[model samples]
Target: MRDAHYEWRCKAITPIWTGDAYQKNGRMIPSGLLGSVRWWFEVLVRGMGGPACDPTDPDSRCPDKHGNRCVVCELFGCTGWARRLQFKIVDSNGQPVQAAIVKDQEFVFHFTPLRPILDEEWALLDLTLRLIADYGAIGGRTVFKPSDERRRENMPQHKDYGLIEITSWPDIKVEERQLRSYLKQSHWRNMDHGDYAWASLDNFWCANGKHLARQNKDDSNFNRVLGRDERKTCKICGDIHDPPNKCPKNNRYPHRHSENLINKNRTNQWIAGDKQESKKVFSFRHPQRTFGFVNPEVIDFSEMKKRLRKAWPDLKDDEFHQGSDLLNDLIRSPGGAP
Candidate 1:
């Protein structure tokens, strides 16, 4: 392990939820934070056209036939290989954090390299952290939303958990060409991933300058984007599929609702028939930003744009960013405003 390490100081804009197995929220869990970091890192790797495997799956996991692991597993670890970095959470005074769930509290992520960390990998991590601070949320309970009835009747107090602001981080830069070369060097980088609909930047989209209006009785923007409880009329039968039943006219199941399409389960019978996580990520608590990855084969760019427009009409064209454009901008200006 290297003697030197990297640290990122962050302030929780809202409550942060790195909870225990019972979902208790008193203490900070390093593994919870690490899992979120690894997830965003995998997304960025796929955005850069690199190979990243589903670590949770047994069939498609790392350490394949030739003992080779995907780029993510190489850094995050697998069954046989250990992670390249040791991670922990600390306070502003550099002491390990015990209790958590405090709002406006500053915390530091301490990352000590277990081996010689690559320049590209470091850059990717930097970008991932910045991306989370700017547009995404970390930890658990990110998908929590109050019921419509609660919104209308009670207006209960809710905290936007996982919203954080990056207060400080090390300056790191690596050329796009070097990153591409590193990805190209991986033997599995170009392998066919048609089966697994993993989140990739190639099919990613992000929008800013919009907030989820919880008080809106007609329809919440979160539900609009997530398609929660929203049913669509079956094209075949001209009947609204409330419970997502089969179409009587055609004897075929209706298309999946937005919720099902966005929050796909690994075992759900779908086109890919492989492990696929949620395609959409909405910073519900932090309403100014929303983003999601789409399977281009399922929902094209035009369709996604239309959906965003419908959900948040105020989203200007300039506020929207595709995966490739965002990646390029990050590479060009590593330290500039995101």
Candidate 2:
């Protein structure tokens, strides 16, 4: 009876934290505190390489603009990892070109000798790999048949196939030493390479259902990629998402701009055109991209102590009414010191 009833058991539900303050068994904690902790862990992984990569090195997207570029960001930008890697090369004659199969996706392969490829050539390979991975098998599609003639008749024709035929592949561990070496060599290059940088830098992607477009709520124009105006676009009011300025209506900006969709159905007094408030009726949000802003020097403990000393004539660090732990925690968090 127990064995039979086990199949009828309901799967446990994991409650999502929405960052609301709540009491858990009498101890107060934010509703999403667990998620917030997970988010911080991910940011640490993305900004500074996790234990796999060097934790001491800064991986935050909000790097010292003048300082080193992040290593975690670089690895993330290197294209997401694929489960089954395969490669193939087809010539103009639709025959397999004899070359080493260095790397492979479902249908495509990077040649061993590093075939001279222009940007267009790489794009063609990229597009072809996308199609094959979505549809075809690694080496090539095979159709089993009773006869040789039947097999030839049914098998999909392709130039040729090279097979690495990996089995029991180990997961690539984060290489902290390699990551450090890579960062040291390429730190200068990382400074200005954010044009193609993806959401791994900022948690902007979390605001959406992990959709790139949905995450970028400040973008006024959807089609433009590298345009100077590219920023996060808010869905509700259709305005660029910025910071430091509240919406004209003075509503508390949603934690993630994506949450504003919930407010869409609610009648907005700002939108209803209350004539007396018409001047303030038009609402706008801040842009997601950091505008041209100078970096202020990081305030160290000694500097903080000096300022506090002047204010209190002698207020000790621990004697302050509020704990400095919260401020210190914010400083260490990935979004980078507030």
Candidate 3:
């Protein structure tokens, strides 16, 4: 680890509930932990263009081509490729850690590189370590908001973020460290992060979004991402709405300019005498997250855009940025370090 020709070893300690449950040797194994961490890593150096695979799909293997595997397979592994790094889940005593049940348990693991960790790889590892520390979850069903949450039951949603312990990491700089920390554990996953919607039930960001522009008879007033808040806007009205203002349209949908962060009672339908039922709706609703559900759910970016329109419409936008645009800027910005 400290030398170039010898292998390097690092340790990770879980601070909250994790969903990595690869059952092997009578213990819950976490074979994909490295791979998961590598994803966030790839997003950092390579920008957004990576493999188009489902990512979480077990069958999602890198295509055999000249660079289809990208940074992931090069650091990890794939068919006809040997993993540059290897890891084993173990206990605090440094023995292989085991879990009889998936939830309510904790484990530790050691990451060892087959060779000296490259500077780029170290950059990835360093960024990931700091992220998990602040965001608060790992493996699956990880990431707790409010930063101080002690359990997954207290978290509003399970995300790609988590809290892990590693002591030997080198110093790095990130100006958006606080924001990235929030993003790693953010509820943005409840919104659409891609083009296709996952389970519609998990789309809670739509609950607070009651803007009638999308359902208004004037087809020109649909929502668009604009402004500092990166919130929604009425393309027809050309005016920013906020603080839960009501739209003048009689489309049965009430436009609440301000987004509701924790209201589970908000509905996607406006009950103005059942007139908006067939409203070509794409709004999300807030329902209680099913307790003890560990598997991650995927949501599309359209729903996310809706939520952004309601919360912060004036945020900046670039030509290409997945999920949140400011997030893309954060990665490229120089002041994000703690």
List model 2 lDDT by residue over 1-338, tens digit each.
Answer: 01110000011011111212342122212222222222232333333322212223344342344543233323222223211112323333434533322234211122321223222222222222222222111221111111112223223221122212221111122223443343355343334323122112121111101001112233322112111223334434555434554454435552334323223221222222133322101100111111000101222234333433432354444442211232233233332222
Q: What is the lDDT of residue 272 in candidate 2?
A: 24
| Model 1: per-residue Cα lDDT over 1-338, one tens digit each | 23479898899877788889887888888899899989888888877778888777777788887888888888889989999999989987889999875678889989999988886777778888887777677986554543333533323234457878888887776767777788768465334555455477676677765555344334455555544534334656556553446777776777534234445543122221323434354545344556666666566667666766776776677887887887777666645322
Sort by lDDT, best first.
Answer: 1, 3, 2
User: Which of the predicted structures, 1 or 3, would earn the higher TM-score when compared with the native?
Assistant: 1
The 10 consecutive residues of candidate 1 with the worst lDDT sum are 266-275
Those runs of model 1 whose alpha carbons end farther than 4 Å from true positions after fitting are 1-3, 146-158, 186-190, 213-218, 228-281, 285-287, 334-338
Please report, in order, the local distance difference test score of every candidate based on alpha carbons: 0.69, 0.25, 0.36
Please tell me which model should have the higher lDDT, number 1 or number 2: 1
lDDT for 26 in candidate 1 is 85
**Top model by lDDT, which number?**
1
